[model samples]
Target: MVASPPARFSVPAVTQPRINEANRKSVGPLSMPPRLLLGPGPSNAHPAVLQALSLRQVGHLDPAFLAMMTEVQELLRYAWQTDNRITIPVSGTGSAAMEATIANVIEPGEVMLVGSMGYFGNRLEDMADRYRADVRTIKKPWGEVFSLEELRSALEEHRPKVMALVHAETSTGACQPLEGVGDLCREYNCLLIADTVTSLGGVPLFVDEWGIDLAYSCSQKGLSCPPGASPFTMSDRAFEKLSQRPGKVPNWYLDMSLVGKYWGAERTYHHTAPINMNYAIREALRLIAEEGLENRWQRHQANAELLWEGLEDLGLVLHVQKQYRLPTLTTVRVPAGVDAKAVTSQLLNDYNIEIGNGLGELGGKVWRIGLMGFNSRPENVILLLAALDRVLAAAGYRK
Candidate 1:
């Protein structure tokens, strides 16, 4: 059929309101300020990872991309020290991965016990509640972690289908000891879910050995990649729970049963994967493999210790006890009569360094400093301390 003379416009096409140019401006090319990210997350992406991010993309299902996908999975298994076959990066942030775990395992009205040790634990409770899980919580002060005995008592009383704990409580800089907590869950015949957002690559995490059934983490923080594309995994037990679930997962985008096919042997397309993010994460995980987990963990620990010592020497108090402190993140008590945000601002505006103020109940009470992945280094630690010393002094903090 011959096309009718090009469709006629209402008035004359040229006279019609030209696509609104009001919102368009001659903006300069994107340029963000140089920032030394020493905050709780989005810690400076490793230079190598950033380089990978700039690499050309491949179709999500292409052989080249699929091969890289497998490599990423293997490296993630190494980083988390788990052999869970369903392990893969979710296509969103840490929060999405966090929700994905809850959405899949806890059928509506099933009890979920959340050990609310800090900010993220509360987040887990919220996500579980939204998923219609019967969310129960046991609380600790912001900077303290739950003892294994406390966890046992909570589990015994709640008898939940799942128990969620933060492996590293970012807001408080407290590392929750998972050694016996997992065993406690197993005793109660409950699946253990762990939030490893701040712990995965920097802290000592043994998912398989620890008896954790489900876990999730971010691309930032310890992984040293940009945010987006979070790591998620489920033990066979957790996957079985998902397989036997009564209905489709409540939230479709994060439902791993469908998402898993794309990452699993089926290679079924669920969504267009974030191609460059996969590249970036591969490079970040590659760095972990090259440096070796032991060496990387040691480097993080050493730098954290250096920072702790330097801060102590400068008369700033660390919020968490040394034994329980996270190598990746630290919470420093705000000095008396000192403005927390001001100190943070001075660090960023004057020194080109960024540190976070606390979140939730800890807000304005502590400063969150991070030594994560590529940003965890002796030089960065020393530079931060020196800058902090000056900033504190300028803020009228006395030694």
Candidate 2:
């Protein structure tokens, strides 16, 4: 026993290496807990979508991948409810899609009449300006919808070559009525363009019926996919505009005339398409197809009604009027004494939930809640109401 005790070996200290110039930027591994995504975008991806993304990777130009891409284009056509041959997904976020539509449609020095209702409406105006178009805005108060009269007056006054509007204003939860505006644009001989980023899939978006010449949407919002892919659809008229551009589009990455070749029958290469993201988008569209368009719209409408009832029961004021409120996104007035940011932070930290704060003029004055696609469910409505009640109570706001 004494001899055995004397044979023990000492252990050496294991030291981690210090940061060197080459490795200084390297970060440690990250761990993220699954949190409920109820923000303006990036709602939860469907399980099937997640499964699709996990499938084996293939070369970007692989025949199978290209076949899948074609299927995706067709599926997007169904989701967009359009037969436009040039419809395809751009390899970027919603903003890229918006830029692509604008760049393709507007020539330098062309006038673009834009609606200024909230943040995204302002973004359209800015994009028009960047593209060297003379931008004219029909301004409406934040949290308010623009009337047909308002849009008609703007069209009469500006006579812009292109009229741009946000079908669903995420910032103020306002859904602009497309029926009259589209007709007005037709009457004015202006190409109608819309940002449907927050309305697609969750709402009834009829590109052809609305006479929208060009429209774009993100996968993350109503499609229940990740944010890297943006679905863009264009009418033949808009494509003709692209064909007749006096000069090259400002952004090559978004040049539809060239990009169409890759997504077209030619199977040419514009850039490396995001293969995995396409898979996710395909799966997301599949889910929407299974749900059926009318049923999906009704589901969103029903969930939004529940949310409205709950918020009203709690004595909260909805920002947008009943007729104009977006079904997928709701904006509620931030009570006078409550700190909107604090309530949002508590909801995120304590409940593992995310909600959006108001944007632009509505900032610090309203809270924007999204009930989009997969995130629009009865359980989510209840969860949000209960959590918000707790938050408001703690903030000394009476229920």
Candidate 3:
């Protein structure tokens, strides 16, 4: 019995790794589908951009990384058509860039005027309030754009220190005109902040020419890069205002003064930059440059026209007026009898095609189809139209 007990007590050696050492565990291979990305954003990245992300990992401050950063700045400058030295990629998405611009420009109690024409404008007003600024907004119905006269009136009445406007409202698919708004801001001695998240690379953006003191965008929408990086530019005057902030910027992570030092020639370290995301953005920007800004803009415009023509031919109506429609994002009015959600679901489940539903007030009533960067191709346009036509027809809705 004692011998048997001894034999039973011979325990097996512990072979599993300790819980604290789980970092040594092997990871499974990643698998992703080959579905077409034609949503409001996160359009398929160019092959080159994907390849860039596959490159061997490097330190954030690696000499090669720094060089790439310089090139990125230059490429962003080309995309934004700005000579401002403060142009750089933020460490987060388009929203981060928006927050950075607002945080750096507006201080507590500062008067900020915004156009409440779409979702992004609502976001801007929210951000201004979060920053403790006195927010004033000019309301317009969703899917409508602000006129120059309306903006001028707001500037005159509010006398805000800064005015924020969205160049392309993704929610409503309306492109707000910046024609005289910048000059109006200048006339009123106020800074002009423009949100170009849905406009950059897909449309023409002349920061200096437009008198935009600050502008920001994301790489995924029109640059064809995977999300996670935001390209933002600030003018010399805006930088001057940031330098004079009486108190520290509200968010240390987004403080442009410190971020600029890291991204600037000093190459200082404020945080560990997302190296792979930067590589993705650099390559995306490079592709945009290779395509030529004017050519890329034209491509988007042509694709948009094709989509609109096809959709209208199929008897669908566009939400925004033709004159104010955004090139990258199109808002389609949901037919009276069709369920917007059901149509989108069928398109995804049956056809494997992904599009966007409208946001805010336009939700459930409109469908957003984005013809952006790499997704702005004839083939995609045709496929989307064909799929949409089938789905709507099956649902007893025309077009």
Candidate 4:
């Protein structure tokens, strides 16, 4: 073979595949309906926040980007009213941050007690199950919240390593009061996790004061940003538990011991952070800082009350009781003969409004209307009320 010079052969020309005209469909520039999102999430982002989202990109590790990241962290700390050293945003939706808490804090066989009052509580149980936790749930009907006594009884009965509660239940529009729940967990030697996904910026939340060992939220709902990046924080107590874990975190992407370095002083590489989402959230949080928390909370409350009054004026029944109702989301009971889906559909199609049909056990029974972040304005409340009155009259509902 060597003597024959390997019998030199000529290669045939290769034709790279081009765009197949048969399979390729012509597409035009992007266009979307200007939908006013008044549903159980993804409320319309503030115009300024959207502008930040569309701003130019930067390398994930650029020094300017790193500085911006620090600003983002400080702003987030203000938003959550926490000084947790490891506060950061996960590079996914709110649910990803939800799982991050379970993944980092739980070992395979640990007992985890969840307060399952609404759909998201069930979600917590499901994620805990996937992590191989021995899950226990203390239940209540949708549109209702567990009392401090109920939680104390559950903690005494389950004696779990971790206890999780939803600070704001999105599905049922109920805000679970957490003022003393954290102390109860401490008495039982259990870590506390709070789901602030629907509460964080819009409602009053005190992570450290309430002793929330771990907490998570979404940017889309209360932060007035898009849905990609989510807020997550852990107290020293939770972090200490994580540090003593017998094994590596079960979910690698969400392992905070590794992910924290990137957000902390070490500045190590984790995954590429969501630069644009960080920018968007920083701007949104900045707006919050400028407006002040008390003012924002008042704004959201005033607007929600406005909506509730208008709904009641229309003879629509509120789902949750007044004291437990969430300021960000409201559940309205469907009139006996009205089709819930039809009402929601009319709101979306005719009025350019988008309120949610119910979820889980509430489907076809209640309508979820959101007044969160930037969307929580008196003008929006008036618009939605006017639209709903018209839509309901057309739907053949007596009231």
Candidate 5:
């Protein structure tokens, strides 16, 4: 009544939840069961690469990291067998590099001729279309490589600005023979972009000799490294086209003009690069260098031959012709009455082996077996053949 002093308020003490071990969620440390990767990609990374990946992380722009980046570029050139100054690893997986090659060099409305041999070739056509290019395709049945004459005819007829092809079709296990096609591209004044995703380290790819204007490959397939930091190289002709584009590159992150500066002397920042992946790839390339490319290619070929012979013994027919078949990836026609997916599942679940089933049109018709990178070994071939034999036999498969 007499204007009493304002009472001070205080926060009431509230009891917190009790910390009990019984109430806490139980989670264990990371541990994955051992697996033999015989699929199209990500054949178990080499021990050296795994160790490198676990090494200390560094800033993308760190001096040591930059030096390593330069080394990685040089090593990639060796792996790709090119002297292209614009060679570098794209920030994402193989598809990112594929997109970069298309988004930068192929301007909207420009005619692009694609050789559709298999699933990957179709992918190239799709990427080019996304760039708004006038895409024209010369398709061969899946598992068949395009002949040089066919390529020449398409190039002459369409006279497209770019001719894209997949060096190794993972879906069909066919290897496109570059051969005189590069000269054909030169004659037609067309740029050649090769998707070497399945062939980069395991197959013979002479970019300069073959006159490939641009190429992209994944790290996981034949590089014996985890997926990410894909290899991308562009020749002077391709770079010139990229530079002369009237409009800005449709993909900001994959724009080679800006990405090149980051990998070049300018060392500009474009994005937060996958530093550990670069380290892993560098070590993988180092392993490649230690084992010469010819030796590595021969190892893949030899192991593939073993697998082929084993499959033959099992009475399984190969999908691709022997001449054009990719040594890194083998597609086996699923025998009549035998489930392809079931075979792969049994191999993974029972044998701890992982093989791939077909993609797109070939799904359930074939099984894609990859003898790539660290997984390309005589013992692996033997294990896969034995495991496959068991699985197919149990599935009631017969010659």
Candidate 6:
């Protein structure tokens, strides 16, 4: 044995390869055209918000950052018109916040009633199903709003733990009225979740008055901030349901139990927060605060009215009826033989303007124009109308 162990086999040593630099390309400085964002969302961020985004970043746990976090929550409360202490900004886009609300409050096997009027409503059903909820969807055609009676019937029949509705259906330019929905939900002992992504800052949203137990919105849409930090609020009743969950929240990242502690007085560390996005959102909220909600809402309404009149003058019909039409986003039916994409493309390429194409069933059949947040201006309305006239004429479509 000693003789056999005397000589061990030696392995060959290969030389390491050097880095290849020949194929590497150096990226140039950032540059882009100044575009008028008239799309369904992400209308131009306020200049102050853009400036705030460039300010130095800070540690997530820094005291200054924590104070800013509290301010952001306060601003969100103002924007949502709610006094709920659970209001905070989720560190993702609106959909993440939407999922956070749906996943936490509705447990597996619990029924969830979805009022599907447009794309976002159907999306809510999808998100609810992903959480293994017993989903029951009551749908209306696209470009339509759900009546209170319809929602009441669905809630009574399904007896769901949650009733989800879209406050503003961006996909169809319809605003679902929430005047009595909260009362209806209360009568059924169900939580009300309002998707306010397109309504939050640009229009009237009385979270407490409307009795919405949970509501979620995005910065990019109505707050005029980049699409990252999204606003979310949970009523005490909703949080109570979340706290009493038999099992841990299915999503670790969106667990309100853990997230609440960080955003609440506990100030615990959960995840590294998006500091710059928070800064941008904070400044955006400040802008909202300075302008006041009523003024902002009026501004949006005025601009939208102008747009509606202009579109009609151009012989374009609106998808949603006037009574239910959304002030923030407008969906126009593509003229009988017009190409929606071609119209949008021409606006982008020739005019540096951006508008959204229809989603889901309405794709290529309509165009979505947003007059929201900072982009909701009379001048913008006039400009977009003029641009559309030129582009449509070029497309050989007569007014």
lDDT of 3 at 357: 86
Which pairs of residues collide in model 1? Answer: none
lDDT-superior candidate, 2 or 4: 4
> Where does candidate 1 stray beyond 4 Å?
1-25
Task: Rate residue 236 of model 5 by lDDT.
Answer: 96
Model 5 over residues 10-102: C-alpha lDDT tens digits?
A: 455556745555654665677997999999988899999999999999898999999999999999999989999999989889999999999
Q: List the residue pairs that clash in candidate 2.
A: none
Candidate that scores best on lDDT:
4
Ten-residue segment with the worst summed lDDT in candidate 3? 19-28
Clashes in candidate 1: how many? 0
Candidate 3 C-alpha RMSD relative to the actual structure? 5.1
Give the least accurate 10-residue stretch of model 1, judged by summed lDDT: 9-18
lDDT of 4 by residue, 42-96 (tens): 9999999999999999999999999999998998899999999989889999999
| Candidate 6 residue lDDT tens string, 38-128 | 9998889999999999999889999999999999989889989999999989999999999999988989899999999888998999999
Winner by lDDT between candidate 4 and candidate 3: 4
- How does each model score on TM-score? 0.95, 0.93, 0.93, 0.95, 0.94, 0.94
- lDDT of the structure predicted as candidate 5: 0.92
Is 4 or 5 the stronger prediction by lDDT? Answer: 4
lDDT of each: 0.92, 0.90, 0.91, 0.93, 0.92, 0.92
**What is the C-alpha lDDT profile of model 1 across 91-132, one tens digit per residue?**
999999999999999999999999998889989988999988
RMSD of 1: 3.0
lDDT of 2: 0.90
